[model samples]
Target: MKIAIAGGTGLVGRALTALLHEQGHEVITLTRGKPKNARHVQWLNGTLPLEQLEGIEAFVNLAGVSLNDGRWTAEQKEAIYHSRMTATEEMLRIVTQLSTPPQVIVNASAVGIYPISTTATYSETSTQRAQDFLGKTVADWEQKASRAKELGIRTCLARFGVILDTEAGALPLIALPYKLFVGGTIGSGKQWLSWIHVHDVARAILHAIETPSLEGAINFAAPQAERMKSFGKTVGRVLNRPHWLPVPSFALQLALGEKSVLVLGGQHVVPDKLMATGFTFQFPTLDEALHDLYKS
Candidate 1:
């Protein structure tokens, strides 16, 4: 299969691109900068390179500004929102112009669309949507991505959970305090965290691309959802550190403002769609994931 990936230089994009190459698929990366190699083609801020993207079989849209780049100021929030909307819109434009539209499109999404809850467990079927900043942003983002379906393209909105990785994403920062022996529960420690290993995240995206019956919102979370307290303990245990000190909610709120929800609040999300599609998670358990990332 020939796959075209927007934002293919990002964290998850990089992993997915590598996996696709390993599986013997030709990959083309849509980029904003100079083409790094034969596999990369510049898209935004220039004419669409129809010749370069011809015969692409699958499109994975992962272009977006990082939410963790800085505090969620009004300008920063606008950048976050517009970045995703613009990139996704560009992808749609490119696909519409293609002589042969891709068979499938896997657009990046986030589980933050689900309402933050400690008791309520959410799956792909859950209709409840969140109203917070991040929640609203994700909700709108997914809606825009869903436009691909109107073009008769099989669209899969991959609602990612907290992606754990050793060098990038959230794990390194989450494990920092643990490495210093100051790690502990943040806020009330009751917030549910729906997390998945970065490897599993990439694999799930590939699965979505290949599965014909899979469409709509698919939670890219692990089967097991852990609360912040237990997640902290696992981090401590894996790092051979102590989970003692506690970071207060006010502290995070003051530091992060509206963005503190990333840590101080969460939802219990499960990958029901992935499970039904017979997708197997390499690190289903948090312990296994942490150990593989830290202890391996």
Candidate 2:
């Protein structure tokens, strides 16, 4: 299968590209510049002008602004929205022009799409749009992916929570305090966090591609969900450090500004849909995932 990955320069995109390539699939990277080879194409203005994706079998849209980059100003918020929406909108237009449109379109969404008010586990069927910035952003993101279904393309939205890797995503940020031996919980440490190993995340994506039954939003998270405070204990145990201190929500808000919600307030999301579909997770427990990541 030939897969074209937008935002192929980022962490998740790079990992997915490697996974697909290892399976002997031809992977094409669509970036900001012009195309230089068959495996790489440039998409300026967040869209391709020609029907370059003529015979592509799958399209993965991972192009979006960093969710934890910094405080969201007026401009940053717009960039975040434009990046995801514009990329999906463009993919729709280009697909309609294709000689044979791609069979599947796998897009990136977030668990933040679920409103933060509820402490309940959120699956694909959960409703009620979140009112916050990140929540609203994900709602729009999924809507964009849902559009691909209109053209008879099998569209799947991989709604991710925190993805664990050595230097990518949230691992570095979460490990910082632990490295300093000041690791602790955020707020009451009761916020539900759904996370997955980098390897599992990549594999699940491939699963989505191969599974003929996959459609609509699919949560790419670990089956077991834990409180933020307990997660601190696992990290501390893995690093053989103390986990006594606690970072209050007010302190987090002060430090991270509006982005603190990502750290202090999180959903207790579950990959119920993924598990029910007969997909087994490699690292179900947080300890197993943390030890593997820290040991390596």
Candidate 3:
């Protein structure tokens, strides 16, 4: 298979691209900058080299601004929303121009589309949509990607949870206080955290690309969702540190502003679609995931 990926330099994008390469698929990465090599193609400018995208079988879009980069100022919020919309619109435009559009498109999404709740358990089938900033952004993002389905292309909206990895994503920051022996629960500690290992995220995306029956929204979360308190203890246990000295909710809100929702609020998301499709998680439990990441 020939695959073209946008935002291939991102954490999840890099992992998925490597997996595709290891499986003997030819990969092309679309970048905003100069083409780094033969496998890299510059896009997102007014013009794209359509010839380079020829024979591409699958298109995976992970393009967007990093929400964790800074506090959510008005300008930063606009950037977050427009960045995703513009990139996805570009993807649709490119596909329409292709003589042979890719059979499948795996567009990135987020579990944040679901409302933040400690009691509510959300799955792909859940219809209750969140109306907050993160939720609205994700809802609009998925709506844009859904355009591919109207073009008769199989589109999979991968609603990712908190992706855990030792080097990138949320794991390092979550584990940092533990490393320093000042780790403890964040906020109320009762907020649910639906997380998946980075390895599993890549696997789930690949599974979506290959599975014919899989379509619509598919969650990329572990089977079990842990509360922040338990999550902290697991991290401490894995790192051989103490889980003490809790960080108050007000402190995070003051520091992160609206961005604090990333940690202080969460949803208990379950991978119902993935599980029903026979997709197995490599790290199904928080303990298993943390141990694998922290092991020396």
Top lDDT prediction, candidate number: 3
Model 2 deviation from the true structure expressed as Cα RMSD, one decimal place? 1.7
Which ranges of candidate 1 are over 4 A from the true structure? none
Error of 2 at 269 (Å): 1.5
lDDT of 1 by residue, 1-296 (tens): 99999999988988999999999999999999999899999988858889989999999999999987899999999999999999999999999999999999999999999999989999888999999888999999999999999999999999999999887877787789999999999999999999999889889999998999999999999999999999999999989999999999999999889988998889999888999989999999999999888765
Off by over 4 Å in 2: 34-37, 46-52
- Per-candidate TM-score against the hidden true structure: 0.98, 0.95, 0.99
In model 3, where is the ten-residue run with the lowest total lDDT?
287-296
Per model, state how many residue pairs clash.
Answer: 0, 0, 0
**Candidate 3 off by > 4 Å:** none
Per-residue accuracy of model 3 over 179-207 as CA lDDT, tens digit each: 99999999999999999999899999999
lDDT of the candidates, in the order given: 0.93, 0.84, 0.94
Residue pairs in collision within model 2: none
- Name the lDDT value of residue 156 in candidate 1: 96
